[model samples]
Target: MAPRRLDLARFAGPTAEFARYLRTETVGGFVLLAATAAALLWANSPWHGAYEAVRDLRVGPHALHLDLTLAQWATDGLLAVFFFVVGLELKRELVIGELSRPRQALLPVAAALGGMIVPAGVALLVGRGAPGMEQAWAIPVATDIAFALGVLALAGTALPTTARVFLLGLAVVDDLGAILLIAVVFSTGIALLALGAVVVLAGLYWMLQRRRVTSPWLYVPIALATWVAMHEAGVHATIAGVLLGLLTRVRADPGESEAPAVRLEHRLQPWSAGLCVPLFALFAAGVPVNGEALRAVVTEPLGQAVAAGLILGKVVGIFGAVLLVVWLTPASRPRGLSWPDVLAVAMLGGVGFTVSLLMAELSLDGADVLTAKAAVLLASAVAALLAAALLVLRSRSHRRAGSRHTDG
Candidate 1:
């Protein structure tokens, strides 16, 4: 028999309620977008100097080569936390989730590759002779999981689980590719000693997991040391976070309800989504959006390439890739995903906010960086709006279809 709940229970559970809300992609998305808006406003407001001063303010132990601007901390330090969350998710998916099967994973792998290749080609073709074209071409080759999934949650409520998984898997693979590029392309000359330390520390982390050690005290310091080593090696510190996350044990023990990886991810996800990512945006998304910047983005070849790669290339690359694979091979679109749904996801892929901003900072300099960032913001905004509209229409279509079936 069911027991009646006491009225006092309702008042006792708001913390759980608040936590539940924070777990949603909708809340995370809106938080990130709000931070971005606030950043832009503050940067363009009368107190613009404060924004720059705060962002450029450096605070770290210079002896360990850790002294860096606050903005750099957000990018290299905090974003690492976000990527660690991503790595845990990817590991789970590969082991037991949607990507467990080679057959099921092929579609997203193809989509990710196509999503990357076509955008690079588009950027290259358009910005061939531009100053930073060599590296800037890779900017739009990545996707922002938070923004994309958030937009989906808001507009794609009626969409099937298959669609969400596809997008999630695609973005994960896309981020992996971008991480590889950062390691290979954007890095300065490597310090072999620091590189060796990173490898050793990461290996030690794996050994700790194998031994069933679960102390945060030990892991946190090692992780921090690994981050510093990676930075010293001229590789991005975020890569260290991903490597550590991947090394963490995900399978539960006999008496455990959740694996260590799962436990850590659950605890860290809220921080990553609600604070780490938003703070990154607060520092990174403060690019000037004045007429001059907008004009440069629209008129300059480099800016056009970035905008086109994100807005046009993503749609064509992703959608066309799915069609080609499904038509030419044994792969088929996931069940319940229609052509319109695919198109909407393709557009959402263009909402390349986080990594695109990182890429802009990494690849360009001075005015070029400013212009590229402005283009990223503009393109992301347009893509989100268009994708939202299409998703809403698709949602209505789904409702009508469901209604007809029920009536039948």
Candidate 2:
């Protein structure tokens, strides 16, 4: 019993540390933004050719079909680590956090559905008859977790904790929706043997977790194999990370100090946030914003459609969905959030990054690719600025109300 008590005390330390890490992710957000700015500047400068050269430089084993460009490595390889952390966090939320309740979970799930559907509709309507309109509609359907959460941390620190949790849950669901869309829309066809291997490996990992097997040496190889299998299966390798995270046992076993999910999240989150995500941004966000690119974005239906979907569509979709859910269903609105807070966060959902770029690459070609990327960048920037203003206003209002209460 005494030993168990000591283990419990130790477990609490990492749990607390994980929460602190989540709060300080603002720093990682800033780092990511800095990398993005640098990429843009370097991409536009005289050294632009060198930047492209480095980005396009390819290396890796050819036999396994692993050879890919530096940019592809950043997106396909490094971002997997980031998504693994996201998976862990999301599973935790489902198990113990705001999303644990069925009623509470419904809100974000509905909002995510709305966020995706409305944007697709908006893009389709606006980009009607345009080249690539068929697939490019998905470009504005994602909300970047890192960028949205970071901006919230910067602008809404004084707001209630529930608002943050709501946004986190919403963003996680939103990204998952985007990933599923990629799977269905872009997949050439799955490699059945490799996918089957991933299923078997993931099952073994789960069995081992349940049996409380704790050897990194054994797990590391299996995890790597799962990732490889997923890649070979013609699905995004990052899905492997999410699958493993969900399979990991989040509950601590008897006499165990910490849950496996919590422990792994604490250790891997720093690497994901500090290194993997920022590197992904550096490589992925280097779209040209020159006069020609800007002109294409503004003058073309594709660009106008994406911008509208992000700025106007996200707001209407998210906010309207929340209201509809509250009025029409038994799902309880998340506490500590008001209509204003919801609206502000809804606006923040418009700042789609990361996945939007991938959609553009997958869906468009030639100068149209550049045009789509430029639209994404410009639209996301506008969304971020608008969300920031609303968030700041809400934070100040919350603070002033708190002050009056204290004085009374």
Candidate 3:
């Protein structure tokens, strides 16, 4: 029994170490955002017609009938990959990240909860009972960790490691809240038969897991079918990504074999983060905003709400909640992260990308809501810029402070 346990530990050690290395060296999220920015610029450029034409272009077999505009393919199809990655991250954090411990999770969880609550409240206040605007409340609740953390990663080594971990945890909790809100608030009318199909598919997935079907290919068709059924069933299709990711395996028990989900997540990480996310960003993060549209953004209620919620509410809410947690719970602050570092992270929280875009689709009028979307894009850009700037400043400040202390 002891020999078996020792052997199992030896096998699992390398896998866990690899997972940590991936987390530490993550560049996919930032690369995706950068690609997304370029796409947005191109879509709104003089070649806007070409951009639209490419998205609307279609090619597929009659039997498959897979015809989608470039945008739809990116949003509806590729984003499943993005959501899948999100699920893996969420699982990892729950298993080993900041949320691994109940006590360690409390601060970020509280901060995320407050961040979600206050932004929606602010959006409601500003929406002023406008028709269809209530649905927009959840728009502000998400924190784009990739964009946010990418901004912080720019600060290099000036920031404390704990601060980044804290932000990462906070963002994960924020995403979980966003997922729940989507399930409850944003879900459209349901199709019972399609939902039943989804349930059956879920059962099949579990059975496969029980039977130890470890090959990822076995689940691919099932996952694809689940996404299609979800789309047909009127659930936001991205939830399929989350569900499928959860269904994947992690490491096995100490003395048992490695879990298939963990193996799958590890295998899929490169593709999901490296390929799917970047492709999705490149296609989805574009809006053809002209000079006229820019002017209209100020008056557009949807635009105003998204802009305010992401830009102002994110930083204000995160910072305030962090402070409140520290005040209420002694020892809440992580060692080596001064208030300034916390402030820098709060600023990075303003970069709302994935959830922001998703919410824009759900809440905004689209086509007609072009102005509002332009507003969202513009606001997101501004927030990213501001957040990056603040992180840079904080980095310098921390370095200078360290130098002075050393001299003293």
Best by lDDT: 1
Q: Model 2 over residues 1-408: C-alpha lDDT tens digits?
A: 000001223335776555445336476667778888988998888899999999999999999898999988887788777767767776777788657888778999899889999998999999999999999999999887677877888999898988877787787678678768877787766999999999999999999998899999988999989988999998888778878887888788789867998788767766776677778778877878878889888889999899989998998999999999999998767787789999999998888877788788778888788888888889989999999999999999999999999999
**Distance from true location, Cα of 260 in model 2, Å:** 1.1
Q: lDDT by residue for model 1 over 13-118, one digit each (tens)?
A: 7764554566677777889999999999999999999999999999999998889999999999999998888778777777876678999888998888889999
Candidate 3 whole-model C-alpha lDDT, 0 to 1: 0.71
lDDT by residue for model 3 over 9-118, one digit each (tens)?
34356765544343432364556667877888889788878877887777554354456566667777777776777786787678866798888898888878877887
The model with the greater TM-score, 1 or 2, is 1
- Which residue pairs in candidate 3 collide? 55-70, 248-261, 249-260, 249-261, 249-262, 250-262, 252-259
Instruction: Report the number of clashing residue pairs per model.
Output: 0, 0, 7
Model 1 scores a TM of: 0.95
Provide the TM-score for each candidate, comma-separated: 0.95, 0.91, 0.86
Task: Please give the distance, in angstroms, between residue 391's alpha carbon in candidate 3 and its true position after superposition.
Answer: 1.9
Best by TM-score: 1
Off by over 4 Å in 2: 1-23
Clashing pairs in 2: none
Choose 2 or 3, whichever is better by lDDT: 2
